[model samples]
Target: MSRRWNPVHPNVTGMLHGGDYNPDQWLDYPHIIDEDFRLMKLASANTFSVNIFGWSAIEPEEGVYRFEWLDSIMDRVAEQGGHIILATPSGARPAWMSEKYPEVLRVEANRVRNLHGVRHNHCFTSPIYRQKTQEMNRKLAERYKEHPALIMWHISNEYGGWCHCDLCQEAFRGWLKNKYDHDLDKLNHAWWTGFWSHRYSSWSQIESPAPHGENQVHGMNLDWQRFVTDQTIDFYQNEIVPLRELTPHIPVTTNFMGNYPHMRPFTGLNYEKFAKHVDVVTWDCYPPWHNDWQSTASLAKDVGFVNDLYRSLKDGQPFLIMECTPSLVNWHEVNKAKRAGMHKLSSIQSIAHGSDSILYFQWRKGRGASEKFHGAVVDHVGHEHTRVFRDVAEVGQVLNQLAPVVGSSMDAKVAIVYDWETDWAIADAQGFGKETKQYAATCQEHYRVFWERGIPVDVITPDKPLDGYKLVIAPMLYMVREGYAAKVESFVHSGGYFVATYATGMVNETDLVNLEGSPGPLKKVLGIWAEEIDTLYPAESRELVMTGGARYEAKDYVELIHLETAEALASFTSDFYKDKPALTVNRLGEGKAFYIASRNETSFQDDLYERLLDELQIGAPFPVQAGKGVSVQVRTDGKTDYVFVMNFTEEQQTVGWPGRSGLANLLTGEHVGEQLELEPYGAVVLSQSRE
Candidate 1:
């Protein structure tokens, strides 16, 4: 199956744009409020998410519900030809509930209950909190079911956090018992609990991983991570099922954090698990705010991967970039401004990948409080005559021209495996180098080669069927859960090329080392077995001498391996492991499986991948003569191809004519010939003739 997704568009008669619009905040200031509509109209925004965090206003006290203010806001948006992504104010517990029912507040890992001032710190497992939010959701759906502006139901704001309180611990024990069939021995053996005499005598003996007592228990930590994720999903399902029954016409969704692999401080959410419950897959994306806006090339690739990953979640359909910034963000250590064209570049990149809509966090900057300084469509200047506003206007104009790409998807023949379990397990196994470095960077290093070559790659999990992808890359995948090794074997044996890098298949799903041999389960399919491993300290380097007379440097770590039924593609030439195989290729059923024993230099990866791709007869999505900081992505309706070429840098660049020449630039309507030049952060969407 190529892809199957049921994408429903509610309240959106056209392309969905706009974002969190808080008219209730300015109910007193009619003059300043009048300008919000004017600015929205200028920006070409059509949707507004209303009443997101108005729980305090919705239900000021127990059993008292208010809706006059929200009713007015809804009617106002309806009159202005805008749709509403009506939100349930469940993300943050109301101050009254937190103060009265203190158990609703989450207890931190340090054993202190969080105060009422913060958002997203609610104990979701609390019955009182659940009852209050249930009533809020029921009332909102009852009132807005007939509202003309109601198109989508936003369940809660970016739901991911954990509560380590006793109540949650009881729930965790219950979860573990149900999963383990109430067999303590099975649970203990799976977690290797007896290694440190930590075996549980009873269900109550199982505790949350956030507590310092079990901080080093890798298996328990992974399970707790999974438990919290399921808890959050269950919470969302409880809210969504009823909303769908009430307002069945409207689609429901919750915003997911795009920094998904690291949203672990709380619920440890895996978007794949949550995607099915929502009508649309949406996430909040913020690239590194550490003042690295020089080119944003690498960050843009991450953006593309996330967008494609979201698209893949619903089986290759369009998703939403629900919350992004038009410019700088306030949460950074030192808030920095996004260079002029960067905002527009980021938005288009999301669209080019697979996003159907672009919505910002807030329409206007907050006047006071923590996020008051955050970037907004309408800045604190009280007017729309600003540089950010102008840049936003340009993006809106471009989006209006992009109605063709509304439901189309980026065509991908390559996929990079992304498993939340592996990602979480790798965090517990972070002593491979001199210091604890994130395994995510190594995963992205593999993604970078294809990204640079304009080759589209989807981020897939082990559960997803690999029927369509010609090539699959799994790097830094340390944990091989049950049945996953079989999945990898099936993909390669079915004539699909596979690549497995260092640290892959070294541990089981339980975070236990494979006692057989390194890459234990996959050793058979991969035809390689590792004897010992060596971690490269900072500044230490090893060389890999390839059979083709090409030499590449391996750094960060090295795995000394001996091949069984595979040929050594390259061998190490350093330390006591001299002449050992560094890279091996095995001829499987009808295809080839390549094993990279260590992290290699970028140039080496690029060179090796180019040869492998050439041998496999795979090519870039499109041919472009653009330089660095330039990227190309292709999407299609299986009839007309949409080609997106973008300049990620702040300097002007030119690209020669593509391989197939009958292309018309969608922006300028110019038939590209010889060369096309783009200004700083310039982007061009072209329609390539399929025939």
Candidate 2:
């Protein structure tokens, strides 16, 4: 018999109805505290994430404790019938700690040791820092073990960034020892240190790799990044393991930065290792302001993909959308407010993709800070009069009315492989590709084709199983880690359709290239030998014509390759490389591997991707209608599926809900027998009660 799939968070079980609540920052304390509870009640919010940035307030001095204020806050929230996801307050260490223990300060890539000012300033490998953080965690856990308000344990806030201190260098050596057993031979082999005379004769000879030194080596600096990630994970485990012993029943987690490029959360810090101590996986998702509708849809799919990855890693336990800005963020140069209905639609999209809870970055607006101007449920005026507040309240009301229809819905048939480690290796490679060859952007382009047609997609990694997906796209797979190529091979050999692009399978786990070919371990399975690579300057492009009479524009990193046992699908039509195969398809065992050798324009990419999907007989969840600014996504629980139709246009635009039969509008409580339409800036959750 298989193991039972436990709910994501057993206590705060149903669709998590909560937002970030920082009452500690308010000076009115008691009066404002009461008002916050009232506002939460009005918004139908039952959960609160507290103590995220309260380290300085809680621990003012060395070994000094001040839980009295927090004690009152927690008790009051519980009295008001709200559940609390208590954070460990390690995100921003107190200024005193940094001043006293300078070792806690982080040294950047340029070897500059930062002074105590910003959050996420401490070095993960600092012994003093780790000890102090662990001490704080123990005290917090011991005090809140049986607290009635406690629902979940939130370990440090958004665990990221790397430190290049001397302590980290020592720690990196130990990490290397454990990984390679202190064998210099294996270490040299893995790093391919021979070409640059970088072979290490002894364990003590190694130093923290930095790109700033006189003899800066990118390969070594990249591995040090991998080292720092492991160190951070170790720090989290130290805190979590002890906390679990005290409160095993309560779930524990740390907020992950979704699709983060640096720190490689997926690889550097082992999710599986941390998942054992964690009950649910949560991430902070902030999409760019300049992104179009397609980008938003792609991001929504990534949120689900990440949740699904965490769920699969944690044995199918649902994950949470820990933090999403309600509206505009502080950083973007021109932060545009999310179009009317887009916020609510995005929330539903999270649920459709496997998020058990929907939470925002902030509940009430900050009076003064870097995020003071950031959008929130309640603005500076502190009332529901603001447009954001009104919109939030409206969403809250809808959530209450259509609770059953919007909660815990899951729908996905195709899964795209997203590996942060592979991304890091490629991005950090000395001479691999251009810095703009972003993994997220590459995968997003492929995902947009499905998202525009309301197709559900799962973003997964190579380690995760590919049992259910009909098509799997792995873009910019630079570093093929251990066993990943085997997994991809197995999936393809079992009659699955796999797609990969340029700069894939170039290196091993340690950034070492496999001399056999560009794809390394995947060469045999992909059936292609890349001989050389060509990088084009901006505005330069090559025309590619498909064998079936489809023409497209291609640019960026183009790989010149020879088909060993594959058929050419498309050929280049420019320069000396004219008529050369630009796209090839190989018959691997019982499956198929499609290889794209150049980055193509979005229109061309969509056409090629759609053609492949058409050939595979994989139908979209809905039909595509001709219209700009209209986006759709499908979410299902294997039976009752929902098609989220949203329009991001200023002018009124009509959108047809394709293949939607016998559907009911979850938002307005109206039933539809066949097709449904949406208006400008209007959104509707069309549910098919019967599959």
Candidate 3:
């Protein structure tokens, strides 16, 4: 039987409503409070993510407690019929705490300690920092455990970044000791420390990877990244244990940054381990409007991928969209306002993924802070007459009409493994590829092809089981972790089709290359051996002629390999490496493994992915060529299916329904038969016809 996601909170109806509400920051508390609640009602907002970044207000002094402000705020919100997702005020530590305990301040990669004023400045390894954070969380959870409005426990604000303080150094040594089992010889072997007279006789000799230091080692810096990720996870688990003890029923989670580079959300910290402690996995997604529409759609699909990551970790639990910018973001220099209807369309896109709730970064504009100019439901103007306000209200009304239609929708079976650790290792590699060739961009390129066709795809880790997916694509996977090759082999042996690209399986988890050969462990499964790597300079290009006589162009980082038993699918067709196998396929056991030796343009990659999908008999949510700029995604809860078709382009596009003759637009409550047309930036939520 397949899995399903259903929220237990009574006030959270079918669809999640409400957003981040910070009434504490507003000066005219009484008037603004009334207006905020009024706006929520007008927008049909139901969930209030409160207490975010309110440490100073809650615990002004070292130990003096003050919950009067929060007390009043929660009481009023509860009275207005709202559910609360209370956040632990750890993101923004108070100025006094930082000034008093300077050790809590985080040291950057350059060894400079940041002063308190800005958020995310606390060191994860700082004892005092953890103590204060835990104390604050304990107090907040104890005080609000039985609060009628309480529904979920949000621990910390978007957990990210790393620390390079003495504490972190000590912690890193301890982590390495455990990982290498205190065997200095193995540690030296893994990091190749003997090359630079860096062999460690004592674990204490190992220091934090600081960019400002003399003789910086990439291997050390790489390990430090992994160590910092583990430290942050430890901090989260520490806080979560106590919070769970207080309110076991309420789910606990910290907001994760989607595709965050620094944290490598998938590995090191082990999202699977983190998921065990977290009840509901939530993430913040804010793709600037200037990014490509296909990229944005791919990001929307990635939300489900993240959810699937958490689900796979926790045995299939639903995830939530904790924070998304409703309007213009303050971070970007030229923050363009989301085009009309684009906001609602994007919000539905999140829901189409496994998002149980959609919440914004802030409900009201900050009066004075780094995020003061950030987008909000109620802008700094303080009235509901603004364009953003009107759009928010319109979205709210649409949610009211479409509440029951798309409350609990699920997606497809195809999963693509996207490993951030592999990305990091690939980026940090010394040789074998061009510096400009990025793993994330390459993986995203492959995933975009499926996303554009409304084919549901999950960005997963290589360690994840591949029982359900028809095809698993792992691009630029440079690091091959322990037992992963065997798992991939097993998946392939079970009639699965796996595709891998160049620069894969070259290194171990420690960032050390496997000296045996290129594509180390994966070579057996691929039935090919990479003899030499051909690095192409900028503007250099090669052509790949498919078996069907279709030719595609390629550039940057081409691998010249010898096919042992694999059949050549495409040849290099350029350079001294001409006539070589640029692409190969090996029939291994009951499955097959395909290898692409170079990076190709979007058209080639898309055609390749589409052909694979066709061979696997994977079906998309909508018909091909329904519209050019319009994208469709389908989610279901067994009984009903909600199809979200969005027009991301500036020009209007028309979409056609082949099987269904008539459907009701959940957003507008309009009836349409067979075919429908959408304006620029328009969106339509179509439910399975009741008739």
TM-scores, each model vs. reference: 0.96, 0.90, 0.93
Over 4 Å off, model 1? 1-7, 10-13, 260-267, 289-295, 434-437, 658-662, 669-671
Top candidate on lDDT is 1
Runs off by more than 4 Å, candidate 3: 8-10, 212-216, 259-273, 291-316, 405-411, 432-435, 689-691
- Distance from true position, residue 640, model 3, in Å? 2.2
lDDT measured at residue 70 in model 2 versus the true structure, 0 to 100: 86
State how far residue 515 of model 2 sits from its true place (Å): 1.3
Which structure is stronger by lDDT: 1 or 2?
Answer: 1
Superposed Cα deviation of residue 588, candidate 2 (Å): 2.8
lDDT tens digits, residue span 1-691, model 1 = 2222233453454457899888767877888778887788899888888888888787888888778888877887789888888998887766778778999999988778988877898887888877777777888888889998888889889887789888889999998889889899989888888777888888876778755555477888888888988898887777776687898888888887755322221126877788878878887877752244434676676666666677788777778888888887777656678886788777888888888778888789988898898988899997879988887777788788787667776677788888878777776674565353456556677878888888888877777888888888888778887887788888889998888887778888888889987787888888988877788777888999998888999887888888998899898887887898888999889988989997788988898889888987788767888889798888777767788889887789988764566578776667777578888888988887666
List ranges where model 2 is wrong by over 4 Å.
Answer: 1-7, 110-112, 211-216, 259-277, 290-317, 405-409, 432-436, 622-628, 657-661
**By how many angstroms RMSD does model 2 differ from the true structure?**
3.5
- C-alpha lDDT values of all predictions: 0.79, 0.72, 0.75
RMSD to the hidden true structure, all candidates: 2.2, 3.5, 2.8
